[model samples]
Target: MRKWGLTLLAVFLTIILTACNQNDSKDEDKKETSEKTSQKKEASQDESGEGFKALKEKELNSQRNKKTTNDSSDNQIIDYTDKQKIAMLLFQPGLDDKFITADDVLKGEYQSKFSDGVKKKHLPKLTVTSLPENTQMDNTPTGTKFYNIQPFPSQYSVNIAMNEHNMIIFGSQSPIPDYNELLHGLDGMAKVYKTKDVIKSEKDNPKLKEVEDKVDMQ
Candidate 1:
């Protein structure tokens, strides 16, 4: 009976040790799985942050490119700077017979100006102003007609008309911003026509000359 009791004690001790070893193995597996899951989550967050940064950079670059294209196109238009050149473009065609009409001047190409943060085309509105009865000439029996333009409220005024001698004259209240370029564009549309030589504005057409001088805008 004593030997049998010692054998049973030995078997019980073996069973307890085996159970403890199995529990320790399961705990180690659980720890390893937890560590792997944490590493995957951190890697996913890093990838999402990198993608968002790349998208933001792309949008900024596209906007910069669009602005550069607009600036380049604006530079392509002509710029004016001279007064005599502008006057010659508007001068009467006494000997050469180059004739420019009000419609041609109105349709001329122009540069743009910025107003209230928006780009506005520099186009002028043309209106025909009739002279007094005394200022009327044989060529213009009713009255001398002048084309005037004062497109912008802040800018100066300009007038163009034929005098009693049939000579074309150009006048302005003050210096125009880009008159040279504007007139040059108008010159491109001039038509050649035959009119008798009458350059008498300085010598004999005093009344019409005075009306021409008085032609201005408010």
Candidate 2:
């Protein structure tokens, strides 16, 4: 009877030790998985921070190295390409009497007009009036032309290309705050598609000449 009791005691001890070992193994595995997940999250955040820093440095360098050009002609013509037009429109003075800087656009301070379901202040709401009768602008896209005569003494028009389906127009009361910042922001946002400046001389737009003549007379 005594020998049988000793053997049963040993079997019970073995069972308890085996169960404890299994539990310890499971706990170790869970801890390792949690640690790996934490490490991955930290790495991702670090990469994002580095990328943002690099981009800001590149933009600053570009601004510092930008060149200035002077046109000797006295044409007094204001012309821009499709890409420039878009950038100028985007960076025009805002409600705060400031431009949407490249940093703002890059940092997601303002959403683009192309953003979906955006009812907020995504685009500038300019006051629009009809163009002068019988005045033709050569660069005017094949659509409607409306004169924006606010916030500036000189009147300009924005053409909406409905027929071509390549452009959309909205008016702004203010002009571009900084051309360099405009180009920088547009480039940062990957918004510039074309770089050539499309010139629209007063000779091409006879109405412009008429308006200038009237202004000079006044």
Q: Give candidates' CA RMSD values in order.
A: 21.2, 20.7
Top-lDDT candidate index: 1
Looking at candidate 2, the ten consecutive residues that score lowest on lDDT are 209-218
lDDT of 1 at 70: 60
**Candidate 1 whole-model C-alpha lDDT, 0 to 1:** 0.41
Can you give the TM-score per candidate against the true fold? 0.24, 0.26
> What does the lDDT read for residue 24 in candidate 2?
100
How well is each residue in 96-208 modelled by candidate 1, as lDDT tens digits?
22222222344442333224432335334323344334332223323333444333222224344432222233433443344332333334322221112322112233333
Off by over 4 Å in 1: 50-218
* lDDT accuracy of residue 128 in candidate 1: 38
TM-score of 2: 0.26
RMSD of 1: 21.2
Which candidate gets the maximum TM-score versus the true structure? 2
